[model samples]
Target: MRILTIIAATLGLWIAATGVSHAEATYAPQKVVYHINGTGGENGAGYKPALNNISNHISAVGADNLDLRVVMHGDGLGLLQAAIDDQQLQGIIAGLKNDGVQFLVCKNTLTGRNIDPETDLFDVWPEDIVPSGVAELGKLQAEGFAYIKP
Candidate 1:
């Protein structure tokens, strides 16, 4: 009877130790997608806030630990326009991209707005443009990406 009790106690301790080790070693990575579609004028008031929000997000999450993507459609394409050309915005976008944040433009909006992506966007690629902005957001959310509209 004493030997059985000792064996049971040893098994309980091993189980408890394994559980603690697993808890310490396991962590879920965060995945986020930000949506921006507001148009900004020459004064740039509308656009500045969105840029700031993106910067804040990157700061909040250690960039290396996050999977981030930004989807732009409608007037939001203006955020990526070549005409705005603010040095701060450029720096932020470049830095974010370096941190693995993808900036995607909506092809439909570009066509409706009559803006040429090749000329209007600073560094957007054809593959980066989605067929529909809102739909893409929905899809990304379903795929386990937390969505933020800013």
Candidate 2:
């Protein structure tokens, strides 16, 4: 647990150092979409390390240079609810949002689960809801965004 925290902190530091860095963004155009459909009662903790990987990515490349998206569907809907269940995760999602990380949720998931997008989902906008998460992934991939499961 301690090691994971340390690593997460390090990743956050790296992300902070970049600060929407344009140089890194212009140097290498990295467009990645993180696909998450966690099983086993999915939530933010299910892939907290994955968040670190994204931050590390920005650190390695640059936020301005990277077109990063975290598309969550199926059980992954738990990510938006994670902070609601565990208050500790409150700012985690907010931080990613601040760094311009696009958090997309499936409309199907929302409808199937009967979750109200505006109220149930934390800080989710209408634009963030996609018709189908899987289809969105395909569209994004076709657009040249690298798909990352982790």
TM-scores of the candidates are 0.74, 0.77
- Candidate 1 residues lying further than 4 Å off, grouped into runs, are 1-28, 82-84
- The per-model lDDT (C-alpha) reads 0.77, 0.81
Residue 85 error, candidate 2, Å = 3.7
Leading candidate by lDDT = 2
lDDT of 2 by residue, 1-150 (tens): 999999988877886786645456346778899988885254566667777887787767766677899999998877787766666565777877787899999999999989997777678889999999999999999999999998
Model 1 quality (TM-score) = 0.74
Could you tell me which 10 consecutive residues in candidate 2 have the lowest summed lDDT? Answer: 18-27
Question: Candidate 1's error at 12, in angstroms?
Answer: 29
lDDT of 2: 0.81
lDDT of 1 by residue, 1-150 (tens): 999999988877886887633222333467889888876777445777776787776666556567888998987787778334676767767887887889888878888889788777777878888988889899999999998877
Once fitted onto the true fold, the runs of candidate 2 whose alpha carbons sit more than 4 angstroms away are 1-27, 40-44
